[model samples]
Target: MLYLSSFTFPNDDMEFDFFMKIKRTCYDSFYPFKVLSRHGFERIDFEPVTILYGGNGSGKSTALNVIAERTKINRDSIYNKSNFYSDYVDMCEMHLKVDIPENSRIITSDDVFDYMLNIRNLNEGIDQKREKLFEEYLDAKYSSFQMNSIADYELLKKVNATKSKTQSRFVRNQLMGNVREYSNGESAFRYFTENIGENGLYILDEPENSLSPMRQMELMKFIEDSARFFGCQFIISTHSPFLLAMRGAKLYDLDENPVEVKRWTELKNVRTYYEFFKRYEDEF
Candidate 1:
């Protein structure tokens, strides 16, 4: 299940050396270089499921991006890349147990959001077509013009078809079905399930963004099953307790100055949630 056995990022000393070599002063920052090294997050040892847990700007996403770039995995959205991004990736290293499958990919929050937006746009277009189809059906069904020649062949067929079928059925036949059946949360969950296949390494960034609590639990179970039964591995950056609590997932606390692995229950976010609920235990 572990295609990427381990990965190493550039440390502060290496970042400093790289900066020392650079003569360009126009660029204000060398991004990914200093991001993870600042927190002493220089390496990740993989498992069936590995989680990078942290608050915003804790380098969780930066680490994932570095790994994804180094591994050369497929990704949909365009990520922020500084002028030195490639050079930074070159300094990093990865040891793989097996060849990374071509289907392996990194899924970012932007990718999921774009997917939902695309679906919404497509459905809007389809709705417009449906309205036009309805009008066409009524017009064709009521038209009294007789087909005098082969020039009217297509129109003749449409007229006959509309006459035999009801308005809804006629319209349905003319247009494709709407693809916006699911809510945003359900759509986001569906995006993961649809993209993830067996025997592939997947990196998911903040997958809990669009999901509700119930949906988050559903996604957690789905990921657990993928890793357990299917030949799959996951590297996820998330603050969701549901995902952080996945069975047998190794979690690195990026919030720590020196990143450390800890149990899901021990994470600050999870503990905060536990305390909040415990304070009002009688309500539930």
Candidate 2:
């Protein structure tokens, strides 16, 4: 299930040596170069389900994107890479247990948000079309003009059809149904289900953004099932305790200086949640 067994990033010394060779000061940053090396995150030994846990600006995302780039996985959203981005990726290495599936992809929050936005936009367009169809139905149903010749056959059919059907039914016949209306959370979850197929590697970046606690738990179960029952592998960056607690998931705490692997319950974020909920146990 582990397509990618391990990956190595350029260390501080490598970044320093690379930067020392660069004489140009026009670029403001060497981004991915210094990002992971800052926390001494030199490598990742992946599992069937591996999670990178960290707060904002903790380089978890950087690591995922780097692996995605190095492994040539599919990505929907365009990530901004600095001038040194290629050089940084070149310095990194990936050890694959097997050839990465062609369907393997990196799913970012932007990808999910964009998918939801597209659905909303499509529904808006369909709604506008439905309004126009309503006006057309009324016009055709009440039109007094007689059919002059064969040229008016299509119009005649429309008039007869509109008159025979109710407004809602006529509009339904004229236009496709609204993209099966779903809330933002539902849309985000759907995006995941639609993209993730069997026996492929999927890198998900902060998938809990639009999901409720209930939905996060649902996703946790879904991911667990995919990894266990299906021949799938996952590399996720997240802070959600629900996702972090997935069965057999190896968690690397990016918050740690040396980026140590630890149990999900031991993560600072999970501990904070536990303490907060424990304090309110009596109220529940």
Candidate 3:
């Protein structure tokens, strides 16, 4: 299930040395250069499931994007980067167990949002087309029949078909059905299930964005099974405890000064949630 065994990036000292040797304009800011270089983010040891956990500005997403870029994996949405983005990527390397599958890709919040939006937009268009189909059906069904020319053959066939079929059947025959309707959470979850495939490596950025707690738990299990049963490995950046608590996942606390690995229960984000729920335990 593990395609990538290790990932190495420039350490703090290396980044500092490179920066000192090179000259940059005062206006040019290398954002991740400072943030990711803080710890020994120089090397990351990956498992079937590797998690990057941290608060905002902690460089977790930066690390995932850097790895995705370096690996030239598939990605749904474009990740934003500073001017020094390539310079930062150049300083990173990976050791792979096997060639990364072509389906291997990175999924970000923007990708999921766009996917849901596209479904909604597609359904709207389909609705309009269906209305037009209704008008066409009525016109065809009630039209006076007079096939005098070859051009009228098409209308003659449609009239015969419409007369034989019911209005609902005629509309169904004329138009494509709308994409299956789903709520935001259902749509978001569908995105993952549809995009992720067997024997592929996936990078998920903040997958909990639109998912409710129940949906998050479902996604947690989906990811767990994907790694365990399917030949899929996942590198995820998330603040959700439901995802954080996936059994046997490697947890790197990016919030730590040195970015050390820790148990999920010991993580600051997880403890915050635990405390909140524990304080109101009796209410439940």
Q: What's the TM-score of each model vs. the native?
A: 0.92, 0.93, 0.89
lDDT of each: 0.93, 0.93, 0.90
Candidate 2 runs further than 4 Å off? 146-157
- Candidate 2 residue-wise lDDT, 20-61, digit = tens: 998889987878777898889999999999999998999989
The candidates, ranked best first by TM-score, are 2, 1, 3
Q: Candidate 3, which segments miss by more than 4 Å at Cα?
A: 20-27, 140-165
Best-performing candidate as measured by TM-score: 2
Colliding residue pairs in candidate 1: none
**How big is the positional error of residue 129 in model 1, measured in Å on the Cα after superposition?**
0.7
Q: Where does candidate 1 stray beyond 4 Å? A: 143-165
> How far does residue 129 in candidate 3 sit from its true spot (Å)?
0.7
* Residues 145-176, model 1: lDDT tens digits: 69899999999999999989999988877789
Which 10 successive residues of model 2 have the least lDDT summed? 172-181
How many clashing pairs per prediction, in order?
0, 0, 0
